[model samples]
Target: MKERIRWMALHGFISGVSKLGARRGDPQARLIADPWVRENPGAFADECRKRGSLIRCRAAFLTFDHGVAHEVLRSDDFSVLEQGSNLPRPLRWIAKKTDPGLLHPLRPPSLLSVEPPAHTRYRKLVSSVFTPRAVAALRERVEQTAASLLDDLDGHDAAVVDIVDKYCSRLPVTVIGDILGVPDEDRPRILHFGELGAPSLDIGVSWQQYQQVQAAIAGFNGWLAGHLRELRGAPGEDLMSQIIRASEEGPRLNEEELQALAGLVLAAGFETTVNLLGNGIRMLLDAPEHLETLAARPELWPNAVEEILRLESPVQMTARAAVKDVDVAGMRVQKGETVIIHLAGANRDPNVFPDPHRFDIERDNAGKHLSFSGGRHFCLGAALARAEGEVGLRTFFERFPHARLAGSGSRRDTRVLRGWSSLPITLDARDAAMSSSG
Candidate 1:
């Protein structure tokens, strides 16, 4: 354990030196190049376990530059991470000013700075909207969107198409817009605001960006408030309308809760799904055999999506505050200490997953990944995200048949949310036979 700490500290020091533009002999790079890190990530987890229940550090395990403190996120220790003092101080500060009607209610309630009962209450009220039955209803709509988007690329001769921007990113946004009754003309504006609301791991929020985001939040709130008023007078079939009606009954969500719930549904619902689709497609394209295998047997689509979620989880990390000093995964965590749980790391743990680096569509146990998280804080939109992934992949391959990556891919800058900004790929219309087989 002492040697491991020294090794990690040395790696951190090396990373700092490299950042100063002082190139050292390829030691650090060579260390990373060692296959053991990828093939045996469990070694690190095991090392952490041997150290103690929890290791207090001012550094991050995922990246050396980031100051995120690490904590082991296990199903057994979920309660500690959820209600503990692990949430980054900055996020807690944001939670204080956060309008419950926006992002606050979607976060875990009580214990955290978020509203009491409101968060959990609101989540339960609208949970049904994202259930398998509800999300499954969007299949036809999602398929139509994919087909229409792909059809636009029919005449293009480009060998590679940017699936991230062209297909993966667009489908979920459109579908969520339809679910929430956002007007076609207003979808882009709403999407922009949603993107701004994405959680950030940075130490501080830019005042300018914060104000801009607040303005956007105000715009969405105003829109939702007006819609709520209308729903009270004459309810519609949309999820917002349902939420409005649900508020009037027992255990109702207040106006602030309504706004927060709607915004969360709009923001988290689509953003995560878009990344899931983008990452999933990129993974499949990288392994043409996997694509061919799925094309030959569409039954594997569901498991294939699960495998993709495991390999490239959209939500990389979740922050929680420790309510009390507690031991976790072998280290002592002091009260009020912030711990960042790396879902990506846990999902890829070798003990939990065999050959964790390889992308295998047939991996039966892939569903066990913590991509959507676990316990009370688990993603409410898991069903919706999965449905979109399955449908998007099925429709995309059915249409393009022979899509291949066009060039280098770009990723979103946000550390908490892992996704592609752009991924160019080429589609062959002539390979329509591949579509019919599925």
Candidate 2:
């Protein structure tokens, strides 16, 4: 009852309001309430872009402009508020008192949910985990993992396979699991936990959704607690063990902070990368010209990954709240107001990329994308994700040059997290398979 009451006060209330506004043809409302609108957000983004760089919506200030989004994300004036922290004092107290003690993705202590000092400390400690040298070292492992996954698909021969379930989802989770010292058996559970808790990253979720995600969070939290205990008892050479040693010996992290950091690193390590692989696969298959170009000029794979991230951003939008009264694009956004930055829109802005809708692997400024986000809270796992995406997609295509999408696959249901849920792919025995099999 407490959970439901608190949820109703926040997520439920926003959901109901958005639905009502959707009926009145509000763009922001439809953007939230209408699934179709979100899946095809370019038109909606264009509408917002036409209005201005920043427009006051019924719920928050919105920005589709790349410059504005970049500024807000990098600016110190914005805060990544703890979930429900903006509510009335009494309600916030209720939220705090009723907390189920799960490590939620969008709540305090999670790197994505806290302001500096805490965020800075967490990022600084974990920063070594994905340094360029570390990513380069892990590249070979990612390549081997990708090759092994692609090899497993050989049994299908001429049959159509759901690559998402069979490969895309497996590669990153497995690799990241190794990095985190999670056992092979536990990786699938981690993936399941990620999938279930993914919608937790979004706002205005339904009451049932809130319940389901909370339950998943509970499962994840319990499993993680045990895993951390196991790691401490028998520390491994993996990064998580390093984090444990550092936290204990360095500026000491509390139990919750440690759990939050571990959970975010593990989840963030694979979730978006999975989306990146899935989206990259679909993009490469759809645009064979780019694929052919990449085949000839394999050096373009990294830039191609950037273009994929820009064209089909794994994360569509992010929000930041004003810590003080600020003037944005001539609009006075008072203190405490939130601003939604359409990352996808920014990637496709005409001012930035010429022929923005077209997928051009040769595009010069492809790396300028805000897909991994920007500013102090920029994605910590970006180097790893980039390595995984480049290696995974390149290896998959090189191994199965004859691969094609067998059918139109289903996309992930959440608006914030974007990717194919079921990508039916068919691959014939390509020439590259002969040497490996021989």
Candidate 3:
């Protein structure tokens, strides 16, 4: 029965992708929400497990003018996909030349774009900044930021407040700004860049939006350039200063690379974290009983955050390209084909996560979720993202134990970023105090 259902789901997904378009945000959502797909949580996984390697599903969504349509593929068989041939063209261009405008190099970098030597060099260069110890050092600062944000929400009596705008979105932006040494006044401007960069998939760039993004990119680069100049003359104790100093080497990031790195950090640091927070808050609120359970046992906050990420990963999927003609599952994938890895679907795989739909905070495998992804492209800021989420959830429950979703919240239209545009939440100060007191 289960096998039959899985087959039906795969067929439905293929049909939907064929009819609506592979990357269509609305259609993809509909496909994901399909009864067949939901019922066969392990459909793709089972296929991969059975094939003993990557399995390709026959589905072609229309690609952007620059992109090529190909079959959807998955593999639990290989630890990492082979590199060189898999490099997507846009990323290939950036890897070959330094382009600052590619702010959020969410795709592979030249260093990370290929295998071995180059990947090693790029990883070595940026690894120090994102080291676990470095991220851990920011713990107290992260906590303070969470506390400060909660404090600001203290007296608000409105029936509902958009947590996405009010709390979830702001915390990471502020934290990333602090890390990059972005000036106090310029934080909002940098966040504007994040807004423009946060779309689900790259809609072939709109000229107006492109200009706005470019201007913001330029503004940030100019700021970093001045900072780099200052740091060159007199060193400081921050990530920017470190990057500036590292550039003294011959292969250092050029002006464009520097800006791209800075912008990537700023955009990703805030955007992903915001989604994590927003999704976490919405999940907790949807299950008030669980929220109450969490309020009673503060120790469970970390695990709760993990479960939230598991159930509601902020990033739904990311695209990769085939380097050469390869077979996945039973189908042949040609070179230059684009493959969309569905993180959201993978996270909910029933074989891996039992009763996957239930938001079980006490689930034993909570920490193992792929919300931060896996392999070479694992989120560099995973540690920082975790710390921010842990602190954010802890502080929110401590401050507003009775907080509840007051109205319907809207999800961002972008499929890649699966989060609330506005999460209306209400807090009862008196209830919070009573809960704490008891």
Best by lDDT: 2
lDDT of 3 by residue, 137-249 (tens): 77778888888888888866554678888899889988887778766787777676677656513332334544554565556557667765666688677776677677656
C-alpha lDDT of all candidate models, in order: 0.62, 0.85, 0.62
Candidate 2 has what TM-score?
0.95
| Candidates sorted on TM-score, descending | 2, 1, 3
Instruction: Please state the error at residue 281 of candidate 3 in Å.
Output: 0.7
TM-score of each: 0.75, 0.95, 0.74
TM-score of 3: 0.74
Give the best candidate by TM-score.
Answer: 2
- Backbone clash pairs for candidate 2 read none
Model 2: lDDT to the true structure: 0.85
